[model samples]
Target chain A: MRSWKNHVRGELQQRDQTEKLPFIGVFTSLSQMEERFEFRKTCLDDVQSKSLDRGGREVGKDTRLLQLQLRESEHLAEKLSQTVSDLTTVLYLKEAELQYWQSRVSHFRQEALSLAKGSNAMKATLSEFEYTVECQSKELAALRTEQKGINQALEQACREKEELLQRWMEEKREEADRLNKYNAAQERWQRFAKQLKKHLHNARTKEFVPIVTSSWCGEAEMSTSVIQRINNTYRDTTMSKL
Target chain B: MADDKDVLRDVWFGRIPTCFLLNQDEVTEREAEPYYLLLPRVSYLTLVTDKVKKHFHKVIRTDDAEEMWFEYEGTPLKWHYPIGVLFDLHASNTVLPWSITVHFKNFPERDLLHCPSHSVIEAHFMSSIKEADALKHKSQVVNDMQKKDHKQLWMGLQNDKFDQFWAMNRKLMEYPTEDGGFRFIPFRIYQTLSDRPFIQKQFRPVSPEGHVHTLGDLLKEVYPVALPTEGGPKRFQVVIHGIEPLLETPLQWLSEHLSHPDSFLHICVIPVPSD
Candidate 1:
């Protein structure tokens, strides 16, 4: 039983150094300490009783074995007391760490709750913004349509102005041509009037006259005027067709 | 839209093509009053009056087979509304005392007038106090007072005529939002269906909410005369008014002739209208 107790103590104490759960290991070691103390007291009582009794050789040998067991148990009891004291400190440290973890969890939970509220508000704001954007897009489309119509009107006005300018140039060219023709006709008429006056003056003052101011002369003059009128009519008809 | 819905009730009054179930045995054997066998069945009503008092009587169904009687106390008159039966096998046949009987035949492919689209719809104008703005309610009076009598009469016909047709028609009143759901409205007739002058149309939208009165329910309330003369097929004139042009032929022909649109006309195809 003493050997088994020693093996259990060794295994339990070894676990304390290898694992982070020192508080649980220390509690198991403390339970073992109480058991070791009980074992030592029983061994010491057996040795003291054997020393007082007068038995056979067997009893004398039992007395020696009990003494040795008593010595080993006493050392084990001391080791167990130290382990129990160490267990008390470990348990205190574990309580402190647990308290720290609980407070940390609470702080993170509150932060998460506030963040969730903020995100929800952001979502609502985003939705309203999206709605506004949609309305703006529709209004922009309408404005663009109106602008397109105005641009088209402006382009049409420009085209009309260009056409009007071209027509004005055409009319000016035709007017200039008519003015030139009228001026030429006026000059010819003025020359004819001068010649007629000069001939009449000659008839009154000069002593001699050309062969005859006769019926043949008058007929020839009328025939030549008719031929000029026919030539002018042919030329005007040809000009109009061209 | 609600105003338009109320008009749907009136739309079926004269609109549905009514069929005649004449006692062929009487109309043919005896000289009768414009009675032709409706081949199908009908639900009708009657209002009685005298020098001193006014009585109202309504017969929901008519039977030719057995004797049946009903008495409503203190009221001088009786009113019956025939709850329409949709299929014949589903129908229960019964005879009102001194009245006629209706047999919704399971397989009457031969005897049936088979009014295809033509239908005569009876108005079930029952009134109530709920919604005062509503002068009349187009509903069945299956309330507590009417429940016992209704059960008694309906059960009396359960032997041969189980109202299998009526039961089937009742099952059809689901999904009211659907287009043709109202077409199966129990007691009302087809809109624009006519037979009198034969004013007709090739197409009409059937309003589903038209009320219906079954022939079985109508005969259950007919007042028996003291003379108790053997009644043949009681020729009842169900006068109706609102109608459409295209559905007149089928409606009129079915009531007067027991003919459906497809059965009577060679070209019986009606184009369904959309809203």
Candidate 2:
């Protein structure tokens, strides 16, 4: 029994040997120490239980709020899902409209390009026509200038012709005057010739009378006197006729 | 037509000297000189009377008392007889200087229209004037016939109607060639203000059909230098001094319009204003 007791003391003393606490080693009896240890354990157990109860109460409150919030989130998620479906349909329709607009824009672009080409051709033709008009106007101006030169030359020629004509007319008038003078001089010459012929005839008749008188009678003085009287009468008559 | 041909054959023109003796009573011997003139064979004695009046330096008065009539030798020559016929009868051997005397009725002695003595015709002044009137009418007719023939010839020549031209102009071209064909009558063109004297161009004896000759062609031949060098073509104006029938006509057509007794036609060239 003493050995058994010693063994128990040894086991119990073994805890003291292993533990270095002064107060714990100062315990009078093992039962009292055990009672104190049991009391400490009980206190620790109460504290742990109270703490556990407080944590459990808090968790219960959180779990209830979380449950309500989870329900609301589920409802919101369903509404959001419907909105997404509707938005997806709208996106599909808009994509179709966008494709139609893109096709129209392409068509309009082609029309604009063709119109631009036509305008460019028209501009070229208009420029060519304007160039032709400018050339024709220049040609017309040249022709007008040439015509003016020709007109001036013609006027000059006419002036020269007029002067020539005036000179010719003056010469003609002079010729006519000379012809008149010649005719008058010719008339005076003819008159002189006629008078000379008359004189010669009278002289011949007077000589014949003297020859006859001298031949018939040798009375020279009387014959001479009669011939002189006859010559004088003949001269008077001839002068009277003239 | 045959009669016209015969008359053309008989017609002759030559220069003759004419004498006028008007103041025979005042001057015992009127020694007036003679003036030369061209006369046709068919010239009337009335033409002689006119010539005498023209040369006498006396105004020809138609009034009976103041008028003068012509006498050949001592007797009054009848005016109705052609000068050629009278020469054939009275003086066939006489050459030129055909003498004629003028008898004025001595104004206050006796009225020429109312003379009484008609046997000798010394006072038959009124009868002589009437004969001269008839002769003038006949001469006018003959002149008109000749003018018509000339116009026909000219028209035919201008239009190049050779047959008609030769038919009408055969008598005018009566002088035959050695080949027994007729020659074209020679004509001349004289320029007014040109340095060259004259241009002698011959008319075609026979013209081709559809050919026409104008004064413009004649001007081109005569005044080639007057043509335009540049600009529009030049036009020439032709004027004739004595022509009255046609003015500014073709050259050939102008031949018939020449004055009486003119040997050749005279033409004046002028430039027409362009404007």
Candidate 3:
């Protein structure tokens, strides 16, 4: 009995070792602990084995889940790289278009400057042409004025010439009248001289008493004598029967 | 037409000294040739006035009567023979053949002033104007009036140089008939001289009216037709007629020329018997 009692006391003191195992270990009350202990050793061993198997299977399933997460990360990196390449191609095309527009704008500015210079040159030429036209118009107007003045002078000279000719004709008529009057007086004087000669000849012959005849008769006799002398003057015998 | 004009130019401008243009009725071509030949033979011609001298340039027929008493018109109102005609009862004077171109002791250059052809005619049957020549001129007038046609005779010739003609007056008074005026009788007058300056005043009845006019009235009109005859200086004790049918009425008197200085006829102024 005594030996049996000692064994019980030692087992009870070694209870801590069994408490770490099994289905229900480390019970608070000693009675249960004792009951379990008294219940059977096989039952405790079966429970420990079942615990080990469950822990190992759970660790393996956790490793398979980590491998699936790594494959998903690699697929995401490939898709991001393809999207960046596409963006670079689109930027290059936009830069080339900007350079072409800059060149075209510079060429258009140069053309505009040249056109402005040509326009200024044309404006100066037009001003010179306009001034030449003004000078020509002034010269033509002066010539027209001079031509009119000369025409007026010519008309005045013609009128003066006509007036002078009319005055000359009147003077000629007066001269003709003067010549006629002188001839008549000369004829009258010649008749008186002839009669005196005839009377002197008759007195020298001593034919009759000296008596003065009519003054008109002596003048008539003198006229006859003077005409006879004139008849005998040129080609004296030419007009004998005068 | 151009050729005809050239021919006429030759005829008009041709100037040989003597030229004869005879009407075919008066002279044939052959007869005119002789006169052209004779033209050069006449060396001298007598002229009474400067006007007459121009007509007879170098063709003179006589040189004896170079000095004579005659008168021509002058200008500026000198004294001219305005009225030397005799009235119906005026005196008669006889003037000798006073040559207008020449004269005797009474030589005068003034003769052409009164008569153009004074040298060609004598004033025989005229008024007795000079005391010396009046008695002889009166006797000569009485002898001239006895002839039957004596009254129609040319008593004197007066020079009319302005008219370029001679004024031949009859021995009797003659009437002048102007178209719109009253009739007037003009008796011919002449100057006469005999011894020294003897003058006689005598006149017979002259122009009697025919159509109530006198015989002398008709003679005045007829004188112009006969005075141009060649025998004017010779036959003019009377007015010598060359045309036939003596002057009762002078009408249509065309010239029928005979030989000059010999062929002579007389014109009578007798009273016509009352109808």
Ten residues in sequence with the least summed lDDT for candidate 2 chain B: B1-10
Error of 1 at A186 (Å): 7.3
**Which candidate should be chosen as best, given lDDT against the real structure?**
2
Which residue pairs clash in candidate 2? none
What DockQ would candidate 3 receive versus the native complex?
Answer: 0.00
Candidate 3 lDDT over A1-242, as tens digits, reads 33422332343233212222221222224334444454334443544455457756434434444544443444446556766764564455346435544665686678778888988898899899889989999998999899999989988988898898788877877666655544454455456446656655654444333234333445445655655675456334334422
Superposition error at A157 for model 3 (Å): 3.3
1 or 2, which is superior by lDDT?
Answer: 2
TM-score of 3: 0.18
Error of 3 at B67 (Å): 99
Chain A TM-scores for all candidates read 0.49, 0.37, 0.32
lDDT per residue, candidate 1, A29-107, as tens digits?
A: 7546655676667776776676667563345666577676767867779888987865674566457546655775797
Quantify all predictions' global Cα lDDT against the true fold.
0.34, 0.45, 0.31
Regions of candidate 2 where Cα sits further than 4 Å from its true position? A1-242, B3-10, B14-17, B26-34, B48-51, B58-65, B106-275
Q: Score the docking of each candidate (DockQ).
A: 0.00, 0.00, 0.00
RMSD of 2: 72.3
Instruction: List interface RMSDs for the candidates, in order.
Output: 48.9, 95.6, 99.9
Clashes of each: 81, 0, 78
